[model samples]
Target: MEPLRTENLRPLDVSENLWDRIFTVAPLVIIGTVEGNSYDLAPKHMATPLGFGNYFGFVCTPRHCTYRNIEKSGEFTVSFPKPDQVVETSLSATPRSGCSDKATDVLQNLSVLQATTVKAPVIAGAYLYLECELFRIIEGFDDYGLITGKIRAAHVDKDYLKVSEVDEREQLMKNPLLAYIAQGRYAKISETFNFPFPKDFKK
Candidate 1:
């Protein structure tokens, strides 16, 4: 590889948003939280595992009900939707109106199931589900906050599970995954390639 000159690089304005200028691939999962009498499902793109353990977290704001509900209930559910359920996942982000329940309207189009460990609901038809208990909420990220949880229980659909007997590439081709391409885009990942790791690499 040849070293390139810095003259070709374009500096971006940091005062405004920088993320929208580029595309990022992220996992899209529906976070479920319990409200007063019902549940609220919100699809979060800026979510990830805290570590290699049973910990999960997502970015949220105080203005959203999902964030406040998790504060009160101390529990939440995560549902990894399949590519076919993209519409339902998108509907879960319906904004709440004045004195109206946004989840109620969206739930009409989505099917939900009770979480086994957490006092929340998981979107039905999702390939993977996780029930989590509140771990901690770290504030002070501008208007956003990190809501983390300790996974109490997890479940996965058989089709999406990997086995020693089955080839990973073939398995993935048979069951595609749903991915959120940041900047308001989504994709169904069907084909994949094995990462070329260095010899004796360890996690």
Candidate 2:
């Protein structure tokens, strides 16, 4: 066999936060929380399940209302919007006026439902919903903070649920999933392939 060529490799600078420079696919979720008399919904792409168990987390900044709301209420909700609902997800990020309440302005234009376990609201028509209680907040990372949550309740749309007889890929093709490509881009995930894990592998 011929030796692999590596002469073209070059060093890259890391001064500008390399993660933002790379193109990565991540789940885009709308985070919901209660703000006094109204509710707030914001789109977050830097979020994921903390581990295999029922824990979730997302990166937040102190400047955002989400961080303060979660701190005040001790709970929040996550809604996974479908591919078709991307417009609504984007709308949630609309900037609010200084004199007006952002939660009131944003919630007035969205379809939402009250969460069962938390005081937060969940987006209607979302494929999945997770009601979470504030677990811990790790701050002091420059300006961003890691907000961890313990999932208290979860809900999923019936159509997106897995079934023994149904082919997962086929179902996904019919109802494509939504993905966020970092750097202000989005994608509709309609095709997928099974990973060929080594034999004797166990979950």
Candidate 3:
């Protein structure tokens, strides 16, 4: 191989969030929690399955009510919104004001469904929903911490369900998944390809 371009890359500042320097594909999910007598919904991109098991984790700051609420209630619901529900997902991030829960106000406008196993609500029309109970909270990551939960129950929309008889690619093509491009961007992923791996690869 020839020599690579050394000057093409620029150094990033450590003081600021380095994530702003580049784009990353992440699953965008809405975290729902009980806030006192009311309910709260917040969209989180830095969320994922903790492992192959029935566990989920998300990054959140102490300043957010979602963290405090989950800390108190010990339960939360994760909703995987569809590509068309991006606007609804964005609305969930609405901030709260003193004596005025603007975010919950946004919730009133959206269709909300109650989870059978959890006390929190799940955003309706989402492809997937996970009802989780707080498993553990690992704090001390600067102002943010990782909140892990044990999935109590899960749900999937029928239209998006996988069928062995159906082509996976075609199934996705008909029901594209939503993706979040960090720092204010979104994508509708319909087309996909299988990853090639060495023979006898196992996870």
lDDT of each: 0.91, 0.90, 0.91
Runs with alpha carbons beyond 4 Å of true place in candidate 1:
1-4, 98-100
Model 2 lDDT at residue 128: 95
- How do all the candidates rank in terms of lDDT, highest first? 1, 3, 2
Extract clashing residue pairs from model 3.
none
Give lDDT tens digits, candidate 2, residues 24-81.
9999999999888788899999899998999999999988989999999999999999
TM-score of each: 0.95, 0.92, 0.93
How well is each residue in 55-169 modelled by candidate 3, as lDDT tens digits? 9999999888899999999999999999999889988887667323754587678889888998888998999999999999999989999999999999999888888888889
Candidate 2, 162: how far from true, in Å?
1.4
- After TM-score superposition, the amount by which residue 149's alpha carbon in candidate 3 deviates from its true location, in angstroms, is 0.4
Across 39-80, the per-residue lDDT of candidate 1 in tens digits comes to: 899999999999899999999999888899999999999999
Give residue 27's lDDT in candidate 2 (0 to 100): 96
Ranking by TM-score: 1, 3, 2
Candidate 2 backbone collisions, by pair: none
Superposition error at 199 for model 3 (Å): 0.7
TM-score of 2: 0.92
- Give the clash total for candidate 2: 0
